[model samples]
Target: MFVRNILSAIIISVAPVSSVLAAGGDTPPIPSQDWSFSGPFGTYDKAALQRGYKIYREVCASCHSMKRVRFRNLEALGYNEDQIKAIAAEYSVEDGPNEDGDMFERAALPSDAFISPFPNDNAAKAANGGAFPPDLSLMTKARANGSNYVHALMTGYKDKLPHGVELSDGQYWNTYFTGNKIAMAPPLMDESISYEDGTIETLDQYAKDISHFLTWAADPYMEERKRTGFKVILFLLIFAGVMYGVKRRIWSNIH
Candidate 1:
């Protein structure tokens, strides 16, 4: 009976103090981030990313710009000269000489940077309501969760929220997005890409693939890094084994 009264009194005292201390209300949780395929500041799958490249080319190229990526960068992602040439030819670049024996706005070649859909900052901001659609060449690196954020944003879009999170009037849920609310409407759906191979188009798979591909585009040397890391681990294991054997042999003499 005495313990119960003490506990009740403690609870009553703590409740009021807790309420007063938390006058600003609770903070929202940081969005959970997925790092299933990340590596350092620059990493991911080459082949999957290559496929993602194809998706970007066939779909995303219409609105977004990968201004840092050149047509030749596709070759690093696994394309041949003919493919690169064909892709490069699809876009026209402007170039001309000036009075100072220099050139500007020269016609784009395979080596040129991917062109922004809007010509300049003023035009881009004017069109996008002050939100310059960012050059995606390294967006994965710039943002947290890197590519998964993109995947989530692309896949995110439903009429509801899972729970706890209150949806704003225009809010949409993305499975991969941090906080599950995103601005871009779902960009991919199953069969969004028409592959002659008849690969079943599932929205989930496309989002995953394209996100992975962008990861690759942002960093094409992932395979090389993985192979090198494997070699390093092997070398360390072998070195550790040899040192252990030497220690045992030295102890045997002392014993």
Candidate 2:
């Protein structure tokens, strides 16, 4: 009877703590999805990467800058040099001092980093109602479960808020965002952009493509690294086998 009372007391003590933890946690769990680049020996889907780049260019680029990625980096998505040059020519970049010490604007070069929509952080915040749009260059690595979070955030907008939750002005509800309130509004819609490769243009599709692209941006050499690792492992296995054979031959007479 004493042991039963003690166990009941422990359960009573733990119940409120568990309830508090469950209720107080704000960030919703993100569901994992299969990706072409997910596992060992996995590689990126080229077509998805291309479509992702197109989506980023049309949608996310307006707010988020990929400062680490150069126009030339598009070659990794299967764009030829001429196509990259043409794409770079579409934007104007600031360049400097042609005998006159003044900065001048010229067409963006293949080597130029992606142009930012806002000139500076303060300007970006001012334009975005005091919310700074983060650069997406390393965003996939910046967040835990990064790809899943990106995909969830892109598709998590809801028309109605949950009960007892009040959002301040300029804040939007996102089911997957931390605290369930995000500053950015829904950025995608059904058939928002046409795909030349005949892929469906749903919001989920857009989210997946952009997530894949961001993953590649975070680790462009992931495939190369995996390939090199595999080769090293194979070489080590073969060398180990040869060493074992030589050891057996050397000790055969002694035993």
Candidate 3:
């Protein structure tokens, strides 16, 4: 009778705790995406990278900065020296003192790092309602799911909020964001930007493109690294086969 009463008490105590735990873990799982640069053999699609650059320049650049990336880095995306020079020249960069001790702004050079959108962090936060827009240079590498998370985040904004959830002012609902509320508004929409390459301008395409580009931004040497690794593996295999043949010939008379 004592054991039965204790068991009943334990069950009663744990049931509500389990229920609360289940209710607290209600955020939806992020869906995995098929990225061109996912696996060991994967390589970035050049056209997609270019499109992604366009999207970043036209839309995302206003809020985000690619501080670690420079204009010359665009060469990896197939931009020639002249093209890169022209593109860099389009933006003004801060330069120092021509014979004097004052700083001035000048046309950006290919060697220059990307110019930030805001003057400083505090200014950025003030402009965006106290949320500091993070630099995109290493954003993909910084996040857990990297490209998948970015793609999901861009596409996760929903028009309808789920039942029982209330959003505070200045907060928007995003299915993939923690707590389903984010400070960022829906960034992409259908037909938001016209692509010069005639690729269909859809939210998914933009998300995928930017994700791919950000992946490249995060690790620009990925293709070269993969190529080098493949070569090393091939060489090792050949070396092993040659050694095995040599061993067999040397041991043939003995065995």
What are the per-residue Cα lDDT tens digits for candidate 3 across 1-255?
999999999999999878854554244666788878778899999999999998899888888899999999999898899999999999998889878889998999999998889999998888888878899999999988889889999998887866666777778888777766788888788899889988989999999999999999999999889999999999999999999999999999994
Ranking by TM-score: 2, 3, 1
- State the displacement of the C-alpha of residue 148, model 3, in Å, after optimal TM-score superposition: 0.9
Per-residue lDDT, model 2, residue 228, is: 97
54-163: candidate 1 lDDT, tens digit per residue: 78877776557888787887777667998888878877877656788666654457888886687776786676445456677787788876666676566556666444
TM-scores for the candidates: 0.67, 0.93, 0.89
Best by lDDT: 2
Write the residue-wise lDDT of candidate 2 on 1-255 in tens digits. Answer: 999999999999999878855664365689898998988889999999999998899988888889999999999999999999999999998889778799999999999998999899998899889998999999989999999889999999888877667789889889888767789988888899899989988999999999999999999999999999999999999999999999999999995
Winner on lDDT between 1 and 2 is 2
Model 1 has an lDDT value of: 0.68
lDDT of 1 at 48: 61
Q: Which regions of candidate 1 are displaced past 4 Å?
A: 1-47, 98-107, 160-183, 244-255
RMSD for each of the candidates: 6.0, 1.9, 3.2
- Pitting candidate 2 against candidate 3, the one with the higher TM-score is 2
